[model samples]
Target: MEKLEEQIAHLTRTVEDLSDVVARQDQEIALLTRRVALLLEREASREAEGTGGVVLGDERPPHY
Candidate 1:
């Protein structure tokens, strides 16, 4: 009976630790998902403006 109790306690602790790790991972995944969505939105806006390929700080092309 004592060994069984010890085993149960150990298992409980392990589960709690795993749960915390999973929770943190879930939060990180949510943050990354939001970042990806924002980047995609910005890219779409740039494409709509016809300047998707324009690098930053570059002068206007000769055609301009």
Candidate 2:
């Protein structure tokens, strides 16, 4: 029937739109995941090198 065909077409378009949205979100999540991994690696390296320090409210900078 024509109505059934219209319904199918509408559903197909909706699915395609959702798929595009999911693909974009997947890419964004992947990028954020990589950034987090890099930051964690850098933090681990700094800690391992024994150069990690704390910042106090009222203290001289580390370079002082």
CA lDDT of 37 in candidate 2? 100
Instruction: Encode model 1's per-residue lDDT on 1-64: one tens digit a residue.
Output: 9999999999999999999999999999999999999999999999999878865576776577
Residue pairs with backbone atoms closer than 3 Å in model 2 (clashes):
none
Per-candidate TM equals 0.80, 0.78
Q: How many angstroms is residue 37 displaced in model 2 relative to the true structure, after the best TM-score fit?
A: 0.6
Worst 10 residues of 1 by lDDT: 54-63
lDDT of 2: 0.95
**lDDT (tens digit, per residue) of candidate 2 on 1-64:** 9999999999999999999999999999999999999999998999999877778889999688
Q: Of the candidates shown, which would achieve the greatest lDDT relative to the real structure?
A: 2
What C-alpha lDDT values do all the predictions have?
Answer: 0.94, 0.95
Which model scores highest in TM-score? 1
